[model samples]
Target: MNEHDLRHLEIPLPFAPQRHSMSDRAQERVQIWAMRFGLLADDAAARRFESLGYARFSAYWCPTASFADMLLVAEWITLFFVFDDLQNQAITTGRLEDYDRLRHTALQVVYERGVTGPVPPVIAALSNLCTRTFPRNSVAWQRRFELNLELWLIGHARENSFRQAGRSPGPAEYPRLRRDASTVLPTVDLAEVIEHTELPDALYFGPSYQEIIATTADIMCLTNDLHSLAVEYDAEDTINMVTTLRDHRGMNLSEAVAEVRRLIDVRIADSQAAAQSITAEMDALHLPPRIRNGVRRCIRDCQSAMAGMELWDRTETVRFTPDEELGATRAIDYNNGFLDASELGRAAPADSRRV
Candidate 1:
């Protein structure tokens, strides 16, 4: 509730920190890419976007990726930030129709590829991303990524419905919704792509692996809610867990913050245990050395992602800071006529040989 409570709150994460060697190059590439798609209005807007440290964030999550893969990962993170801001604006302004339309456009871009006709800058950028990245991975990975993306979009709609009704989700219902809405699952899927490895369907959907992913999502959502608490509270956004706990669970501000922090700790512990369980299960299965190593690497990637996100939030990103302090100029309006539709089109079909 108070700045002091948030400032003093510490969420412990056990993973060691790491950063990509190509982070600076990746950052520069993403800025240019964003400008090409009209996501950044001008030099000033580009600078503001850079100040957000998205490239560093991506680098932390994917420290071992090649330069090309790192750039793709950074681009995805940048797109997520832009999409989140635009969606938040739509929901806050009660523009549910626009929000729904944006969701549909995004889904279409991923599902159909090379979407023709004019679209918003974000959608256009997404189409470009999919065209460039999808062919590098397997059909199975693509399908998994698409499903997670759909869940994330649907989760936004669910949150918007609560906002339109002027109500917060009950505490019991929030965790499930937050997991999908956080978009962490897709990022996890991206890890597999970046590593050029895939888990068999059975291992991926197993209880232990699923638990690890769910706990990671919970940790991410709760950590974000805590860091952005002051900003969201100032904006009167009631969708965050802290707000939900305070309003729906009848807890005071201090109590709510403490409770959310407590929940994060619990989830972190659960995530570690799940990781251990999955490793043991893999050993028990006596899988081939290659498959075992791939699975283990994937698990490490998820832990790295969690740690990377926390480190970026704490040290690099200016997102939780006030706009005035950062001299931020561009607003989150994707329909402001800045997008050029000339280059927008459907991507070529997926190469069946990529898998």
Candidate 2:
């Protein structure tokens, strides 16, 4: 699609966009936390990060989270974007070895819940996040989060391999890879953490719930691809859904975008169907009201996340601009003492510490 068409493209998400009352405060905290960990190199980098409006994105994604919980979610969003940009650079430069090592260190930090020695600032920041967030959830939830994260990391590796080989996955195989690479699964898991509700394993793993999650991933992924088409094309990235359709399905740019829009509508319908089916089943089984409500809330949150992503892309984020250059020259430095993993979860004076 051309620039004008892309700008005017309508993403028909069902949920109303909403933001938390503390989005500005949470944004400030995320900036300080990012600078403290050297995720932002200097004032320019800090300004670039702030312009992405990730804290607002997080607020929209988890509109009901408490201020403290919103802080955690915003931090996670910041880490995700920082890591994504770094990985993109690795892929662009064909530095697969570096990408693999970064992926390994990230997985290690998430799995171990702490760092044993000196590591890159990104890895150290992740370890601190894991330490603070993991202990708050059940073992089941933790395992699910870890698994989703591993899949996300592996998905990046797969994309890097594809890029290195100068080949795209067949359309049949692209969606699964795209879903994993989208990182929406773990984002959903974090939403659960923010909501302070965990679905029992049986319900969470059931066909209906899994379907809803999968469809939500598709919607979010395709919507992102739609909005980011111009930027990715400029970057010579061909893994996006729009590019996939044009390259593999014998469609033009306009045709490919139309097909993607159709697919997103279908996925939205499927998600709603799965949500209704699961809620009805819960009612029939006489599940506790709390359990049913929690399930409902989870589904609603997924919709909110979808809406938030589209809204952020259209109105808030500077990420799709060609000149944005996310993560450019942003080195990981850990000299700022706020990265101490031991101090992560502890309550301290506001100026001294913030998660």
lDDT of 2 by residue, 225-296 (tens): 888887778777868887777778888888888888899899989998898889766765677877777777
Cα-based TM-score, every candidate: 0.90, 0.89
lDDT per residue, candidate 1, 1-355, as tens digits? 4743463245678876578888888888998888888777776677677787787788876878888988888898888878788777776666677667667767867886546454667877887887877777778878888899899899988887887787789999999998988888888888877888777777778888899889988987888888777667766776889889878879888888789978988988898889888877777667678877777777777787787777676667777764554565435454352223333343233343111
Query: Where does model 1 exceed 4 Å of error?
Result: 4-9, 284-286, 323-355
The C-alpha RMSD of each candidate to the native structure, in angstroms, is 3.5, 5.5
- The best candidate by TM-score is 1
RMSD versus native structure for model 1: 3.5
* Count of clashes, each model: 3, 0
**Clashing residue pairs in candidate 1, if any?**
114-346, 114-347, 115-346
lDDT of 2: 0.76
**Model 1: number of backbone collisions:** 3
